[model samples]
Target chain A: MQNENLYKELLRRFRLKVTLTRLHVLDVLANTPVALSHADITEQLAEYDIDKVTLYRTLNAFTKCGLAHKVATEDRNWLYALHMPDDAPSEVTSDHAHFVCDECERIYCLPMETGNNTRDIKEEQGFVIRSQEYRLHGTCPECHTQFSQQ
Target chain B: MQNENLYKELLRRFRLKVTLTRLHVLDVLANTPVALSHADITEQLAEYDIDKVTLYRTLNAFTKCGLAHKVATEDRNWLYALHMPDDAPSEVTSDHAHFVCDECERIYCLPMETGNNTRDIKEEQGFVIRSQEYRLHGTCPECHTQFSQQ
Candidate 1:
């Protein structure tokens, strides 16, 4: 999907009031494959003159509305990514595994097999396990090769 | 382990000189079963007269030395629990499952299996995956029963 239409559709589907800053934020995230931290977005969108609070609120709303998913990094801030809306029918969540690059500090969502039974986990405590986010940390292929070269 | 002994051992094991503030911080974390955020420790140890910066540094050292493990929570603050030294020499570091209680906001380490293979996961990425932390979140059995009764 083109930039303008993606944001327009996102706003319509999420019932979010469309705004330039929000669209720009969405656009930046949509184009990227790996998840991004708030610092990443702030630096990336610094040219746009967007307010920090607006960015926070926009990301928070997108996360709540199933337009994006949050990956918790070691540094204790959320790394988020565009969760393609049309992939899974039920809801948008980060059930997929993640890879946090130790050197570059990038987080990527590694897709896993779907229909994984979580009942064994839930039955143990009568606990409702709603969603799962699994992360596997390592150097990315690019970083791994660079480290070996050095 | 008692407070005084634990504090002294922490200093010796981590190769830091024994200090009043570090001891207090260590005591607070060790006494509590729940994984504590820095903010949580600060609030609880307010009377101990420790500097926040010192506390953060101490935590970083402890994490590096394998004296503690960081548990990921939704709040985006690094939460830590003391890694109790195990009797088994082979299993020094914590490879156990951790449970985060929804009602109590406590993180409990449940004794269970660990070191699940990632060789298959690596096949998908052609990347050498390193360590992983798996945390399960839910109401504890106690809370589950209480909620059901109500």
Candidate 2:
């Protein structure tokens, strides 16, 4: 499929070796709208019987090459998502903040809004900010409804 | 000391049993300007010969009772800090964002700034937000300076 080809091209672009595990991981990340932890990815790729160390190494390579980024969750799990280019609009990108449902431990990508820029902080605090992550912890709509019903 | 009494008072208010281990942990958290992981806290309390399980339990109790808040870091370590009341100004509170230095992996508490409120996101997204944590990743002043010099 075109996505598979694109994943291959991305791997080549990032100078990463083209491996089946990397491609599979990319496919999983691309299809997932929200970031997923390593465990989630492993579950999704269960049919492949991918080696755990291989999968971890593949993810690390992707992260180091800017192909993906990881978000830290409250449970100390790092959720991995693709890093889409600025021109590409993707739900999993770091362009916006993420909402984590405290009750269910699910992560959702929230839309980006204005007036939350970190440039001022960088200037004032003298920090060389390479990246930033904004995470909101709360009850999602489904969990809110469930709690209300309870 | 006056601070010791305050720690005891806090433990009493939170209904946590007053113990030497708890007191030491609170003292460590209270004195630290930046958040610390369990390992960091353990290192700080090495002289006390505290049990790992007991330390973890005490931390969990403190976190459950809202005496402390944990911020997830890049390495999947949860950095623990005190959750000061709104009237109290503390460097470790969630009132502001946190900055983690990628080079040194040191976490610093940034001052709260205007125009970064999450109320609008909550209204638009329909999430029942209990608390929010904003994290910025970059190089700290020392690391930046070192990198620049290098």
Candidate 3:
């Protein structure tokens, strides 16, 4: 999608105001394969006229309103990615499992065939659960095959 | 286990050399109900003479050798907890699902009945996965009941 359309749609979906900073941050996350940390997002926006405090505030805002999702890696760095609407599960978003490639050190969002519907489990366990995030660490397919060949 | 026993066993389990700093850090995590951040650990060890850099280094060493587990909350701070042996499922380790109480902001590690065996999924998906961590966010039973009563 074009930057302008994506910005407008994200603003509408998240009930956030159409500020340039918010839109720019959203754009960076949308294009990233792996979730980016706050420092990472800042590094990417080094050319832009934004400060650390503002970036932190904007990211917090995106998270509070559900425009973005957060994932933590082994380093315990909180990485941010664009979140999909709770009602909609597509190729992206929180519905899928996260796979990190050990060899390449890249992260992939493995799309799920179905939404992580845990109603039955929650009912059985009697948990008033609201959300779930699953993270997997491993070698990617290429690395697997390469290692097997060696 | 007593503090001394825990410290000794932790060093042995993780093949780590025993030091007063390491023992003190492990002692702090053993007493904490949830994973703690570097700052939190520092605060807990205020009576001790450990410096901030040493605290950070000790936490990293503990995590690297599998003596403890690190988790990041929404605030982007790293929290530490002792990791259990793979054969034993415990309340403090990575052998369970993490549930964060939304109202109180307290984190709970619920013991999982079965290990999340992902070999089949990895085979079907053709990815060589190393590990997985599951996280859930919602109200704990106490909070749930209290909120419902209102």
Candidate 4:
């Protein structure tokens, strides 16, 4: 998708207005296949005239409104990506596993059957429960073979 | 276990000296049957001389040494708790689900069947992955019946 279309579509899907900063942040994630952490995104936008506070706010907003979701990394820093799917609601794609390579630090979203569902669980507290994310860590096929060869 | 026992055992487990603060933090978690966020732990430890940074460091230390594990809460804020026996290291107990009450706002960890191991998924990207934590969100049995009656 083009940068303009992605930004506009994200705005509509999340029911939030798209500022230039938000668009830039979204564009970065949409353009990359791997998940990017807060620091990663900021470093990438170092030349885009984006402020640190604004970047934080934009990423937080993206998470809250479902435009994006938080991805956990081995280093404990929070990572995020463009979560807007084409046909299904975000929940379908949102409840999936994450694959991190053992060689490189890149993170990829892997959708597999994990028998991981929570629709049957009910809220015991008063806080409205919204959504959840799952992550699976392992060596990718290439990395697995690479490590085996060495 | 008594506060003293919990403290001493944790120190032995982590190969660290038992400090007054670490003891107090463990007491709070021991008393707290469910997983707690950093804010929750700090508020509980307000009567002590513990600093927020210290509590974070202590928790991180505890987590790294396997005395505790960080659990995912519905809120983005990370939650921590002692690793229970059901959560043995062999299988993936991290895939267990959590219940956040829409009424009381308390988060409860609920155990479910084991989720699929992701070792079979095709690799994407070269990011190195060292571990995986999976969490599901939903309501508890108590709240489920309560909602049905209402």
Candidate 5:
């Protein structure tokens, strides 16, 4: 989708106002394949005159509304990624998983399989399930290659 | 193990200096059934005169050496809990998963299932396995009960 239309439509869907910061955040997240941290966005969007607190709130709003997903790393760093309305159906609040490279600290979004059985898993354990997140941390191909070479 | 031995042996194994701050962190984590955030630890250890920055550093060092596991919630809050030397075998760096209550925002550490096959699952997908973290986000029984009542 084009940046302009994608931004406007997403805001409408999420019932959020159409603002430059929101649009810029979507553009930045949409432009990247890997997840981004708040610092990353602040640095990336610095030219747009967006402040850190607003960027934080914008990302939080986006994640809450399913317009984006939050990525958490081993270092306790949080990253965000775009997840369109279609990516997560009502049944699976977060159907996708993250592949985190322990060496590089990058997060990769994996192709998610539908029908999240996590809800069932928790229910079977006698706990009610609300949502789920799965993250795999390790060396990516590049890091694995370098490690093997060493 | 008692607090005295647990703190001393854990510090020795991690090759860290035994200090009040470090010992306080261990005690705080050891005493809690749930993972704690930096604020939680600060509040819990307030009377001990441990400053917030020192408490934060202690938690970071513990997580790095595997003395504790950092739990990241959906809201991007990081929590810490003890990982006894016996709990996480090298095969599964984090053998357990957490159940985070969306309403009350508490993280419950679930008894881990040993020999996590996430590595194998990713290998089947042609991605090299490194480490894995699984988090379940939902309402706790208390919240669930309250919500149903409402």
Candidate 6:
């Protein structure tokens, strides 16, 4: 399929050896809008019969090669998501904030205001800031509505 | 010591039973300017010979009672810090940012600009934001100087 080729090309671009597990993992990350944990990814790839250690290794490799990124959750766990390199002017791959629902513990991406960038502090403090993560803890719209009803 | 009484009073305020281990942990967190990991806290309290499980339980209790907060690092680990209740207008316990050094892996607290508060998005998007954590990843000044010198 065309999607498989695209995934293969992406692995090549990241200088990773093409593997079936890697392709399937990439496919899952690419399709999911919200970030997912290792357990979540494993559950999604259940039919593939991928080994848990292999999946973790693939995820780690993807993160190291900048193909994917990990967002830390409140429970000291990590959620992985694919980088949207093709989306021009995409905040998903750029500097943005993630809204974490306290109730359901779901992570949602939010476009950050460019005005709040760390350039000012970097210059003033002489720190070489390479990247930033802003995590806003809250009740998501769905959770908020559900809480109000209860 | 007077510090012990103060720590006990803090525990009483949070309705937690005063114990020697909790007092020592609070003392360590109070004196440390930067956030510390569980390992760091354990090492610091090694003289007391505290059990790892007990320390973890104490930390969880502190976090639950708002006596301390955890900042997630680039790694899937957390660094803990105490809440400064007496420092009037202190950003330490308020909504602030944390700078994580990629080289030394040290975490520093940064005072965030009040203008960048999430109040706007909370009103516009109807998300009930309870807290915000901005994590800036970079090389700290010491690490930057060391790397440049080499």
* True lDDT of residue A130, candidate 6: 73
lDDT of 6 by residue, B1-150 (tens): 349998898898877999999999999998867899999999998899999999989998888777888887767787898875663323323566888888889898776655565557654787887777887777888899999999
**Each model's iRMS:** 3.5, 2.0, 3.6, 5.5, 3.6, 2.0
Task: Report lDDT per candidate.
Answer: 0.72, 0.77, 0.70, 0.66, 0.75, 0.79
Docking class of 4: acceptable
In candidate 5, what are the lDDT values of residues B102-133, reduced to their tens digit? 77788988764445445566667545665566
Candidate 2 chain B minimal-lDDT segment of 10 residues: B87-96
Candidate 3, superposed: residue stretches over 4 Å from native: A1-3, A19-24, A38-57, A86-96, A111-127, A142-150, B1-3, B86-96, B112-119, B145-150
Q: What is the TM-score of each candidate against the true structure?
A: 0.82, 0.84, 0.74, 0.71, 0.79, 0.87
List per-candidate RMSD values in Å. 3.4, 3.8, 4.7, 4.8, 3.8, 3.4
List where candidate 2 sits over 4 angstroms from the true fold: A86-96, A110-112, A117-122, A141-150, B86-96, B117-122, B142-150
Better of 2 and 6 by lDDT: 6
The list of candidate 4 runs beyond 4 A from truth reads A1-3, A6-22, A72-76, A88-94, A101-105, A112-132, A141-150, B1-3, B51-54, B72-76, B84-105, B110-112, B115-119, B122-131, B141-150
Give the Cα error of residue A26 in candidate 6, in Å. 1.9
Ranking by TM-score: 6, 2, 1, 5, 3, 4
Give the per-residue lDDT of model 1 (tens digit) for B107-134. Answer: 7765544434443556466565665555
lDDT of 6 at B51: 98
**Comparison by DockQ, 4 against 6, better one:** 6
Residue B102 miss distance in model 6 (angstroms): 1.4
- Consecutive 10-residue window with the lowest summed lDDT within model 2 chain A: A87-96
Lowest summed-lDDT stretch of 10 residues in model 1 chain B? B87-96
Cα lDDT tens digits, model 5, A51-136, are 88898899888887778877766656788888865533233275567788877888988755445455566777656875666667
| Residue B121 in model 4: lDDT | 39
TM-score of chain B of 6: 0.83
Q: Could you say which candidate leads in TM-score?
A: 6
